[model samples]
Target: MFSLRLLLSLIMLVGIVLTVTFSSILSTRDAKHEVEELFDAQMVQTAKMLEQFYVDQLTEDQLAQLISQPILFHVDDSKIETFAEQANPNTLSYEHKLSFQLLSSTGQILAYSDSSGEQQLTTFNPGYDTRIIDRELWHVYSFFSEPHQVWIVTAQRDDVRQELVSLIISNTWRAPLIITPIMMFFMLVLTYYLFKPVKLLERHLDKRPAQDLSPINFTLPTELASTQKALNSYLLRISETMIRERRFSADAAHELKTPLAIIKLHSDGLSDVLSSQSPDVKQATLPYIEAIGEGVNRISHTVEQLLLLSRVDAIEALNKTDCKLQNIIENVINQLVHIIADYEWYIVVPKDMIINVDPFYIELVLKNIIENACKYSPTESLISIKVTQDDQQTMICVADQGCGMSDEEIALAKNRFYRVDENTSQGAGLGLSICQHIISLHHGELTFSRVQPHGLDVCIVLPRAQS
Candidate 1:
């Protein structure tokens, strides 16, 4: 009934997801930065250990000879391989990959601490800033001191920084799993308090009496203020329309009762006068008395038609039965037999055209159409009634060779209280409206078309009966 609950829940759910995801990203970055800094500090200690060997004051030739040994014994040089292994200290953290390099001031690799083999060394350049080094390498060099000509480089290839960041992300996401249910539980509790007024309003509505015209009495919630205002507006409109309809029905009853009482009093006087009068006197009084009688009869008929129309409006559906479509057409034609005597009646029908509808309702629809045709048709004009059926639908059409209506007239024909000739005094202006309503009850379509050469054709379609 209210869209608030749906809209609120969606917004809260999205907010929870973004909060959890962004927090994980920030925590992972902090943990990675700290671990990378610790690894780089260990690289500085390894560079200090290499500088002690150079301080023993070995000749430049001897230092170059030791540095120039084959990086590994893969070239059949055991001397170079042994010295390479001895230069590497038995450190605590080097089981993964122990590597070091001796570099000229120009940054050429003179020796490697890895006896495994020489790795491609083309990536480094002399006098470049250390910022270009990656987190995975953890490098340190001796560029800060004088005689920057010789440099000792040391690094460990643990990949522990990336692994630490991955671990932080994995652990941080577990918070979201814990957070989701907690948020849902919090949302559930908050929503109960949030929509308290709506629930009270629902209970109030459920317990209301069928004809209750009272305004809803929900306590105003600050969160749902607009909702309460809208409900009040709708309630006021319903009350006003109900009052109007009650007055209309009461007026109709009072207006009809007065004329019926007057007609009865007049009829009684006429009956007494006729009984006591002689034959000659009776003949003179008969015409005036009969005129009064005819007036009463017309009024009674009009009142009955008006009441019947009221009943049709109040009904939601009519009784339905599958009966002969042709029979309904014949009833209308038969009632107008005298009027059509001078004119030809063309009736068409298929062998099978049964439709589901109330017989009385069908008769009412047919009577109104035929009478309208009779009044407008010229002398000796033909009227046609045809009933046709197909697998998908059934159609009933009636047409008259009369002075046909214009397009604008046809459009207004089905509206309530409308007539093609506003000045012509005749039946009440509600027949076509009732006919359209009845057809709608049967789930049918009613169409009016101007026939060629001065005529009007009205067709009604009903869904065909299933085989």
Candidate 2:
């Protein structure tokens, strides 16, 4: 995908090139027309000068000699030169392209330049005309001088006029051609710098943690402020909804605890009363009472988990104390002593390494993962918790010899209330979901994988606390 900066730069470049091209075309054409008009005026002026200066004063012999040889003098006598000498040494090798012919009113040639050869440049008409001589085209300007009773004609070769026009047009177009690319380069660079804020905003959003819904914190250009405001507003709405859900879960858990305890207490009392009866009465009544007790216990456990989920974020944020990794793991193992009774356990973590985190939340995550492993695995299965570190991050791996799950199950494990085995009703399937949220709050990741030879493995990665 092309960035906005590049797209805008291309647009401006195309527009500038087109505008320059169009302007050059129009200016060149106008310049060519002006040059042609000026050349024609000069031709008229030359004819008039010849008529006034030498036409009537020439004797027949002098006129005949002049016919064979053209006069070569600059209008300013101070700059006179022989016809054989060049007019401009700086110009391309000069050729005598200008020729003149003097004729009577009845079309009889009185005098003509040697350059004219044997050609009548045009009829004795009082205007401009194009004529061909020796297959070469010439532009001739003719006028009648009434006092001299003569027609004066001045002609220039068509090829020479064309060469002059081309030179003027090339010079006119040169500046824009040379300067346009430089302007386009700066325009592209300026456009990129001008849009720097937009690029910064994009990178900021892309790097943000998925669970971080905080408002953006940066000053923006006026044009982008509205976009930023809309994004913040949506984030605020999502935050409010999450807060409400957390509050509801906490309140419902608090409300259910009392009734669930009462139910357990009544079931235990009933079981005690039936134990004193005969074997036949005990057999049927005790099992029902035990089932009622188990149901109550399950409900109570679920309520406690819900309550922990509700307050995990706020609690973790408030508890920013440094604690040793070994101490936290020992506390979690103590809490799960009863559940892990049927499992073989191992821990490989340093006793001196410290982590900056909430002890309660960290222990809660460990408890949930360990409890999950025990619940799924067969009795006396091998379970291990290993911790290691690198320069930038801390890693914890929990492996269990449980029946492994499929790819689909591992993917959905982080979703709330999603269970790998739908037939098992022992848990509400919120254990891994809650663990994921807790890890994410601490800027960490929790991932599930299949252990080799029919087992499950989980890994937690967190950034190392700076000393």
Candidate 3:
């Protein structure tokens, strides 16, 4: 999964790092250039000072002695520490890297610093130049003194400028290196807060009940205001559509009940009138009248089931009360006694078992389940009603010795109007669907399974009531 927060943070972090890196590179380059120019200026100034103050004032005899032997500034290794201590303590170590040479017009070295050695720093070119002296690279500045007719050369080792440049670059990089991670952390925190409204919207939708189409009432950022309004608009449309559908189902079923009752009454009256006719006429007409009555009854049953289904579909909450499970089961059995009389019932329910449920709906669910068992099973076949409870939940199971449904049929049993054997059963197939909806309103589960030796087991699980 790709996260928006991660993507935003990475883009911002990379942008910041690249900006800092580019800035540091440019700054290091500029600082290096300035340091080189300053050092070069110092070299030119030193060469001019040496010509104006020292060499130009030299006596003829002194010049003759310099041409005979050059004056060397080299110090003995044993006296180096004493010399260093005696010098200025604040002087930089790289000061020794700077060297100067005074050459005669004929190219004989008249005077030189110890670090410069006997060789010339550069050729007689009277300007800035670079050369390798004693295998060390140096930046050389040479000047010709017109009065003295000698060359004044000052040179500094390249490593001195390189070391200072390296120090400036390293110090420049150190700040960004330490601050980058801290910046990234803060960016991530900012991104999380910025996206918090999206997470809140998701949690609100996920926790809502299926039938809940209420508009979201959260105070979100202005950027998401349009999204919230669009979502609320869609939910309002859906809620209105469902309301129309439920009302239609209830109204259609209610409108059908009166006509079906009248038809049944007329059929019953016709059967009585046929009884007074001749034996031949009665035999011919009785079967047709009976068929008409059966059809009306089936349609009436379907209408009632449709009304109940609509009621279950529209229910968003349950009116719950603590009811005795045994009493509920007894009531369902008594209502179904006419159909269950032919079947052998084996019931196992604890006397003190209590459940928190809407009594009217739970009773309807049990009646449908037990009535289904009696309808499917053969006469004298065993039908079992078992109630079991654990710490967290209560389970009620109804098992019957009947030709059970196949796996494919059981998978789709709860769908509205889905029947395993439509020709054999006189049902509208809304019973299980209504039961499922009611149980779901109570936050419960309904499951169907095949029993051994050919039967179906229907079970419902409900959460245990809190103390």
Provide the TM-score for each candidate, comma-separated.
0.52, 0.81, 0.82
Give the distance in Å from residue 191's predicted Cα in candidate 2 to where it truly belongs: 2.8
Q: How many residue pairs collide in each prediction?
A: 0, 0, 0
Candidate 1, poorest ten consecutive residues by summed lDDT: 75-84
- lDDT pick, better of 2 and 3: 3
Per-candidate Cα RMSD to the true structure, in Å, reads 11.2, 5.0, 4.6
- The lDDT of each candidate is 0.68, 0.80, 0.89
The residue ranges of model 3 lying beyond 4 angstroms of the native Cα positions read 75-96, 114-116, 133-136, 262-298, 338-346, 371-384, 399-429, 447-458
TM-score, predicted candidate 3 vs. hidden true structure = 0.82
lDDT of 3 at 261: 90
Candidate No. with top lDDT? 3
Between 1 and 2, whose lDDT is larger? 2
Q: Candidate 1 on 1-467: residue-level lDDT in tens?
A: 75676568767978888888788788878877887777677666766666665524546775576566523312222332221144334332334344566666555565665422344222344222232233344333333223435566655454445655676777899879888978887887787778877888888878664345567666767766777777778888887785566456546845886878788687878778787989988888878788887667766655655666666756655788888777877786788787768777788887657888888988898888887777788878888888778888888888999988999999898886686777763556677777887887777878899999889998888888765
